[model samples]
Each structure stands twice: as structure tokens, then as C-alpha cells.
Target: MYRKYFKRLIDIILSGMGLIVLSWLFLILIIAIKVTSPGPILFKQKRIGKDRQNFQIYKFRSMRIDTPDVPTHLLENPDQWITSIGKILRKSSLDELPQLINIFKGDMSIIGPRPALWSQNNLADERDKYGANTILPGLTGLAQISGRDELSILTKSKLDGKYVENITFLGDFKLFFGTFVSVLSADGVAEGANKKNSNEKK
Candidate 1:
């Protein structure tokens, strides 16, 4: 019941309210990104979603237009492509605020597995093995709170599987708020590369 109905209901209510309340912040980020970088304010890319569906995930642009379309985790020197403001946004995770729109659009939920990139075939295949790709992708999830950029892809996929098995109304709410707490403390964000790369995709 929760997965099929209540989840989307809550997502609509919360995401709609979030966008309304954060309208001012959205405008600020838009202008800030525009002035700091010479590119589109929003980054969009093909990400594998529920049931192996492909969708464009939206995020605030924090990289230069010339930045390569590769995961920051694999980049040799991600800092070179990041703008000054992008650094703060990446650390603070303000770079993800634009994803509220994705939640509202039904391409994502407030909490679930983070969408893997289409190029991340290995990760996607792992998710399939764990049955983690059977539901909508999310803005945050167990893997995100567990270790985020620090977790190995295999471990992250395992956590996503665990989250799927444990999905519930109350459980989702807890994880949703836990993500905010993680962000506040700047915990489990980065490992080898800058944390902002997670949202800088596309």
C-alpha cells in the first residue's frame, strides 16, 4: 500500500511544499550559478531509474560548461572544473536543491535509491542483482546516509537492496530526515573526490 500509493502521495505533498517554501532559495541559486559559471543553471542527464527506466535527473549546475561528462570520483583533478561558488555549494550540498523538481515530477522520490547514471552500467547491473532498481529513484537513500561518496559501489548497491526490503512509510520518513542531518554535519560526503560531483552530473 505504501509503495504503490502513499509514497507518491507523500512525495507530492512534501515536494510541492518544499518548492513553494524554497522558491526564494531557488532563485538565489539560479543567479549565483549563472554569475559564477558560463553555462546552464540546471544540469540534466540520463540516469537509470525504477525498473531500469531512463530519465533526466535535474541538479543545480556547479561545474563549468567544458567539464567532462564523467563521475568526479573517477576524475583526476575535479577541482579544476569547479567554480569558486561551486566549491561551497558542493560541500554544503546546496547543489542538490534543484532535485526537488525531480521529486515533484515523479521521476524521483524524497527517499529511495539514488539514481545511477546510464553510463554506470556496472552499478546498474549490481542494482538489478539486488532488486534495488525496481522502484523509483530518490533524492536520498540508505546508501547516501551510510557513506555516500565514501562507500564502494558494491556496498552502496547492497545498502540500496536493504532499503528496498525495508521500505515503509515511517522508515522512509526517518531516512528522509536523516539525510538532512547528514547534510548538516557534512558527514559521509566525500572520499577520493569532491562530494559535489554527485550532483554535478551531466
Candidate 2:
């Protein structure tokens, strides 16, 4: 009942209120990105969403205009592509604020599996095994709180599956609160490709 109905309701209410409450911050970020970089304020990229659907996920632009469209972890030198302001945005996760619009539009939830890049077939296939691909992706999720950029793809998918198996209001509440703590502490974040490569090699 919570997953099917009320979860989405809460997403709508919370996201809507968030957008309104955070509009000032958005305006500030918009100006910052413009002053520090030469690109659109928002970056749109294809991501695998609910039931494996392809959707354009929105983010505050954190990379240079010429940065490759591939994931930051795939970049040879992600720091070179990241602007000064972008570095702070990425580290603090302010770059993800635009996803509140995604939540409001029903493309995502406040808590669930983080969406995979559209090209991440291996991760998607792994998620299929746990039936985690059928639900709405989230701004943050169990995998994120567990280890963020530190977890291997297989492990992340497994945790995502676990989240799917136990969707409840209480669980969502904990994950949501955990997200704040995680952000404040900057926990488990990997700034470049090294962590992903190291985890894959392990």
C-alpha cells in the first residue's frame, strides 16, 4: 500500500514544497554556474528509470561544456572537466537539487534505487536479477547510503534489490534522514574514477 500509493503522494508533496522552498538557492546556483562556466545551467542525461525506461535525468551542470557525455567515473581526468564551483557542487551534492523536479514529475521517488546511466547495461542486468528495475528510481537510495561510490556494481545492485524487497514508510523515513547525514558528512563519495576502478578490480 505504501509503495503503490502513498509513497508517490509523499514524493509529490515533498518535492513540490522543496522546489518552492529552495528556489532562492536554485537562482544562486544558476548565477554561479553561469559565472564560472560556459554551459547551460542544467545538465540533462539519459538514465534508466522505472521498469527500465529511458528518461532524461536533470542535474545542475557541474562539468565543463566540452566534458564528455559519459559518466564522471569513466572520464580519464574528471577534475579537469569539473569547474571550481562544480567541484563544490559535486562534493556537497547540490548538483542533484534539480532532481527534485524529477521527483515532482513522477520520474523518480525520494527513496529507492538510484537510476543507472542508460548505457550501464551490466548494472541494469544485475538489478534485473533482484527485480529492482521495475520501480521508480530515487534521488538517493539504500546503495547510496551504504557506500555511495565505494561499492562495487554488483554489491550496489544487491542492496537496491534489498530495498525493493522491503519498501515501507518507516524504511523510507530512515533512508531520507540518512541522506541528510550522508550529505552533511560527505560520506562515501568518490571524486573521480579511481574508486570505481579500484572496486571493479577488487
- Per TM-score, the best of the predicted structures is 2
Candidate 1 residues 45-65, lDDT tens each?
888988998998888877888
Cα error, residue 17 of model 1, in Å, equals: 0.9
Q: Model 2, range 48-83, lDDT digits (tens) per residue?
A: 999999998899988888876666776667888888
Of candidate 1, the 10-residue stretch with the lowest lDDT total is 191-200
Local distance difference test, per candidate? Answer: 0.83, 0.87
- What local lDDT does model 2 show for residue 59? 91
For each candidate in turn, the TM-score is 0.92, 0.95
